[model samples]
Every structure is written in C-alpha cells, then in structure tokens.
Target: EAKEYAIYIGKMGKVGLMILLVTITSVVCQKSRDWHVGVDTVNPSGTVVHGHANIPLHRGDDGNLNANVHGSRVFGGPYNREQTVGGGLQYEHNSGLHGGLDATNMRGYGTRYSATVGGSRRLGPGTFSIDGGASRLPGSSRTEGNVWATYSVP
Candidate 1:
C-alpha cells in the first residue's frame, strides 16, 4: 500500500507542475508588446556604464520599423575618462529591402557618420542581393565605401 501511495504522489506532483506551467504561459501570452530598454554596469578595477533603448515606430503586415539609441561612459581607467552617445533608425519591408543610418560622437573625439542600403529579390531559381555602405570615421578626412552582391538558392 505504501508503494501505491508513493506512485500516486509522484503523479500528482507532475500534474501540479503542468498546471503551473500552463498558467504562467497564458499570463505571458496575454501581455502587450512595447519598446525595450536595457542597462549594463561593470566594475572590475575600472568602472563602465552603458544604456540602450529600442522604440518601435511601426508594425504591420508588410514589415516593421524601429529606432535605437545608446550611450556609454567609462571612469577611473588608464585612458582617464570617456563617453559616447549615438542613435540610429532601421527599417524593413516585405519586398526584401532594408537600410539604416547611424552616427556617434565621443568626448575629445570627432563624430563618425555612416549609412547603409540593400535590397534582395528573386532572380530565376535563386535570390540576388546587392548591399552597399559608406562611412567616415572620427577625426578622418577620407570616406570609406564598399559594395557587394550575393546570390543564393535552396
């Protein structure tokens, strides 16, 4: 009789766990989606703090759009101290098109700027894409650019 009681208790424990999981899943699924924010702090000899956020601009059947912003600060390091802030906008479409523009500035350093554009489409039995970008680094007079094409089939 003790062996039977032990078996019944094990089954009951499993059933209780299953019910808890279902309740948690339902609560999570019913929550609304929104923007995201995050922060990081580390202190190993030196100290560093970073924060970022993602704001949703639009969401539809075609695609989605979002804006991102971030900043970082360093203290008590060999380099003394430094800080940087930047933000960018990104977009996507159902037609296989995407692009983004970004810029950042660092204290005691010049600002850097960059932009990227790319698109992909069906070509015969495969897909073809062309991506290109250009950027000018901080405190640099020369601008760098690159372009490439890719084809893939599966």
Candidate 2:
C-alpha cells in the first residue's frame, strides 16, 4: 500500500526510463514467512516516473539480502545505480551495548567492489564505531576505529 518514486536532471540531454522489480522474503522454517513485490519506472532524462513500494517481511534470521531497510531512495531506478549491495550482515543482541559486522560490494562510477567488516558499541548516551573499507572509490580504503563517551552532571 506504499508508493514512492523520484526524478533527476543531469547532462544526459536525452530521455530514458528504468524499471525495477522488488521482492522481499523471510525464512522461518517454512511457516509464517512474509513476502511482497512491486514495480518502478524512471525516464531516460533522469526523471522518475513515480511508482514504488515496500513489502513487509518477518525478521527472524536478521541476515538477508536487501532486508536492512524497508524503504529505499531509488526504487524506480536501475539496481546498478545503487552504491552498495549484498555482502553485509548485521546482528544486534542488546540495546545498551550492541554491535554488527558488515560486508558490502560497491558499484557506480566511483565505487570499488570489496568486503568490509566493522562493529560498534553504545554505552549509555555515548556510542563508538569503527569502519575499514577497501573499495574503488577514493578516500574509502582504510582501517579506523574510535571511542566516544559522554557524561551528564545531574
């Protein structure tokens, strides 16, 4: 029941259209799994035709393809336009302190394909995270980590 689309203007100086078909599914021992699908279209002139949807799925494994966010910014455009896809899995067990590791393949003009792994923990009101990724993009291939703590005087 959700629909969304987008449009853009570039130096292409022409008209083109791209369509998208999306499907979301969950594996829960072959019972009570959820699935949904939709279509989107974009014009050749970097214009969005307007048509998008977000299929709801049950989160049991929490490690699936394209299952991170229910909504996307580029639903009507080509999948190749996406910056990152697949290879990243996340799992958080606790609220006060939780971390997730991720690996993703980068695409597009300045994106390199590489697997990345990073984790972060949140302590009270402060959170710390580290990211080390090797990709085709400039300024995006290094190992880094940080810790931040905040205190409140009541």
Candidate 3:
C-alpha cells in the first residue's frame, strides 16, 4: 500500500507539469504571401516549430534575396531525437546565387561553434553556387569548400 501511494504521487507530479507546459504550446504556425502553414507538435516532433519572417533582402518584383532559420530539440532515448547536431550561417543575393555553410557542434555528445562564407553567379540560363567554411572546437576541426551548379526547370 505504501509503495503504491508513492508511485501515484510521482505520476501525478509529472502529469501536472506536462499539463502546465502543454497549455502554452497548443498551437504553432506561420504564414506567407503564397503559403499558410501549421504544425501539430503534441505528437512525434513534440512541438510545432517553424519560421515565417519576411526575410531581410530582395532585388526586385521578380528578384529576391531571402534568408531562413529553423531548429528543434526532441525528447526520449532510442528516439533520442534530442542532441545538438549542427548550426550554420548562409547568404544569398539576387540573380540566383544561393550558398550556405554549417557546423556540427558535439554533433552527438557535446557542443561546438562553426562559420561559413559563400558566393554565387548566373550563367546563360543557369545559376552556380560556391561555398567555403569551417568548424572548430576544443580539439577537432572540419574544413570544406565546394561549388555546385544547377539550371532552371523551365
């Protein structure tokens, strides 16, 4: 009987905490000129998180320089979807040039910091992107630079 009472008390405590926090996260969403989005975070991903910022740059009615950011930290072990994996900074300019660089801090165990720089150019009917950056921590470092090309679908 005593053991049962203790177990019940512990269970109640956890339930009370979840109820309090869940109330504040009942809804997660974002909206844009051509898109409206919503995410139900109470389930698998745990919390619907997203970005809907207007972006900081643009070239013209048909040209654009947009930036974006997103993040999530989940719970549980096997599904331990919870670990500090990677972070990065990116840049883009009008004329179809898009580039990004990222770093994985303690990718699976601890913490880290990273940085990146990139540029892009346009070719006859096609666009090219070039990126260079590196990540470093207490005793480890990963450096990389690359160029990729792609043409429009139409």
* Best-matching candidate per TM-score: 1
- Write one digit per residue (lDDT tens) for candidate 2, span 99-144: 3344334444342334344455554776665544443343466545
CA lDDT of 13 in candidate 3?
A: 43
State how far residue 128 of model 2 sits from its true place (Å).
Answer: 12
| Candidate 3 deviant stretches above 4 angstroms | 1-68, 77-81, 85-89, 95-108, 137-154
Q: Give the per-residue lDDT digits (tens) of candidate 1, residues 21-89.
A: 334434543343432323233455434445555667788999878777666555444543577889888
Residue 91 local lDDT, model 1: 87
Please give each candidate's TM-score: 0.59, 0.31, 0.41
| lDDT of the candidates, in the order given | 0.66, 0.35, 0.41
Candidate 1 lowest-lDDT run of ten: 32-41
What are the C-alpha RMSDs, in order, of all predicted structures? 14.9, 10.0, 9.5
Clashing pairs in model 3, backbone N/Cα/C closer than 3 A: 77-80
Error of 3 at 22 (Å): 13
Stretches > 4 Å off in candidate 1: 1-44, 120-130, 148-154
Residues 1-154, candidate 3, lDDT per residue (tens digit)?
A: 2223323444354344344333323332132232122323445434322222233344465445444333333333243344333444445555444455454544355555555555556657765555555555635566433444445433
Which residue pairs in candidate 2 have backbone atoms (N, alpha carbon, C) closer than 3 angstroms, thus clashing? Answer: 7-48, 15-44, 16-43, 16-44, 16-45, 17-44, 87-103, 112-136
Which predicted model would earn the best lDDT? 1
lDDT of model 1 at position 50: 50
Provide the lowest-lDDT 10-residue window in model 3: 28-37
Better of 2 and 3 by TM-score: 3
